[model samples]
Target: MPVREDKRGQERVWETRGSLPEPMLPLPFTVRKTRKETHDTYTLELQSESRPGGLAFAAGQFNMLYAFGVGEVPVSISGDPAAPEVLVHTVRAVGPVTRAISGVKPGDMLGVRGPFGTRWPLEDALGSDVVVVAGGIGLAPLRPALYQLFRRRRDYKRVALLYGARSPRDILYRRELGRWDKRPGVDVHVTVDHATEGWGGNEGVVTALIPKVEFDPAATVVMVCGPEIMMRFTVIEFQKRGVPSEKIYISMERNMQCGIGFCGHCQLGPYFVCKDGPVFRFGTIETFFGRREM
Candidate 1:
């Protein structure tokens, strides 16, 4: 069986080719490869221990990664969902836990627990015009969704990507972004908040690029991620253009204490960002979304 069927006869779709013990436990995975993505950021590719083959995860879900002796942090899974042979995560080291994770070298062993949280609603987005808005590291979580769309191009109408970063040096997946921008039927517009020598991209926030892209706001499904403030403003822009709140989705980055909803650290009003979301339909959480300090 490609997946394990429980006593009740429900199929476990997330089982890797060979499968592992359980999804909730921190399964050991050896870092197989690493790539430097900017000065302070890197991406790690891991192979599961003893047949932890390709881990199945929806786009926008995260894994709680434990760097032996350092700490654990919730990081988005940033790989193609169709390929199930490797696990990937792109991280920007800003805190102690993340710093330790970025310091890991190939062949090092780490523990991972997840494929948690909701997805980007790629299924619902099919047959509709698609607008993807990302800021800085926010692009990491959206990478998989883009991969799926391109691989199955006939499933959607027009597609556009609007990305903004703090600076040219801060752009994540620069090489891939270039390639994607060149892909037929995909429109990519990237901007920067600030620039230095040799930089020639748009000099503004992400929302500015929104108005510049051509899409039927009434027919588009929007997916946005970044700092909470950026998402708030991006949503407002889409709303002004006639996109309904129900069609706008945003990924929430919170201080996740536990991958499960047991911990209250990621609480957002009545919902737990870790379990109930991390990705939420803007309409569902619209009232409390822009509230101060939430």
Candidate 2:
């Protein structure tokens, strides 16, 4: 297999002897641990079937996990890149593929491929004020980036997190979010579109909590992830507050087939979301991102 590093970061081409490139091939992994995040979603920790340390990925990258004879789907690594020996995936059993994958218990085997796609701009935002906004499962993809930012808290000026969910039950990591919120120099603001009987905080939308967090719009780097509509509105809110388009980044979720850009299923205008992104500058995708049929 020919190896090359292109726009998609380092490429690890997997090939059989005298055969075509098979980067999409899966490697066996055993489930190490499992914890239910909610009534329907659970976090699964997997380890390489043979080696303790098989692969390392950047904070925001993902893996295509295949259940035995079931199906496959891309799940972002929710754990810190610093501890890559254990791969953590928070899975919501919302559909057939996910249900099949999430049903496996400890010691069940699964196939894994890729530390694929672009990563969160943790390094680029090091010296600037950093703000992370997440919605629902979108937080899974940003959790590692947040871990990296918090690991080097002194390198940046200010760090804040604004998150929202449909309801209290839909929140992914309640305890973790609380712990991070209590840390020095770290601020977290959480809101929900719908609330429970005991809910006591903000109650409109995530954007409602934006003003509550402290950050300078011009000097801040904003990283957002959620539904496309939510991301679009969040970007608009930041732009209205003097944040430039370049410093604002969004993680784009697409129907990714071939993670290395061989397939055209994830095209976004002129670029492929799988290879060119999953993470992109807001200004880069601003044109066709929100169009109804683009």
Candidate 3:
């Protein structure tokens, strides 16, 4: 097993041939709790006695969760990295496998395989300004990164989060966003496509809120997660603001059949999204990022 330290000097278990005998094998994890995040989204808290200390995962990594006989899907770890005792995943019941996983009872067991892919570069962004942009359900994957930044607020300068949803009701973590906005030195802005009754927030694309927050583009690191088109425009917006493409990271999702890149279902140009990244620097994939033909 290869053990390495991230920029924070925290030991992390990088999955390797020595870490496990079978990379495809799934371990049993008892579903501890489930919470309805929205009309179609559910957050599951899973526990496994097989590993008492819990799953050590960085912010932007995902797990190949197996729902018994149904099959598997890659879900990002949405919980705080500091509290790894209970693994948490926010799942949207959009497909058959996800529906099965999200419908599981508290005592049901789900097979868990990995904490794979690249992570948000929080350590490298230390002492710089940080901006997070999320759209719709895309907030799930970015949640863990926000937890770490808030936990160590003094390490960075200005911090901001700009999020968008279809409507106010579609907001994922409403309460937490309120709390985050109250924190000193942090700015949180939210918008929706449609303005429903009783909704008083900004009503537009997330990019419109970008100008509302203040940050030094030269020293800012921006992390984005959203629909492909949304991310494309986000990168363009940030670039126009003078944020370099190398400082902008985006999380992507594809047809990831094999979590370890054996199947090549998630190939993006020359990079295998499963092995190389789910989080990639915007400049690296600019050519094929928003192309449907890719």
Models, CA RMSD each: 4.3, 4.0, 3.4
Error of 1 at 173 (Å): 0.5
lDDT (0-100) at residue 34 of candidate 2? 91
In terms of TM-score, the best-performing candidate is 3
Per-residue accuracy of model 1 over 9-67 as CA lDDT, tens digit each: 22232322213345456788899999999999999999886765567787878888988
Q: Considering lDDT, which of the candidate structures 1 and 2 is the better prediction for this target?
A: 1
Regions of model 3 farther than 4 Å from truth: 1-21
**At residue 139, what lDDT does model 2 achieve?**
95
TM-score of 2: 0.92
**Model 3 / residue 237 / CA error / Å:** 0.4
- Model 1: residues with Cα > 4 Å off, grouped in runs: 1-24
Candidate 2, 70: how far from true, in Å?
0.9
lDDT of 3: 0.87
**Number of colliding residue pairs in model 1:** 2
Off by over 4 Å in 2: 1-22
Q: Against the unseen true structure, what C-alpha lDDT does each candidate score?
A: 0.85, 0.83, 0.87
Among all windows of 10 consecutive residues in model 1, the one with the lowest summed lDDT is 9-18
What number of clashing residue pairs does each candidate have, in the order they appear?
A: 2, 0, 0
TM-scores for every candidate against the unseen true structure:
0.92, 0.92, 0.94
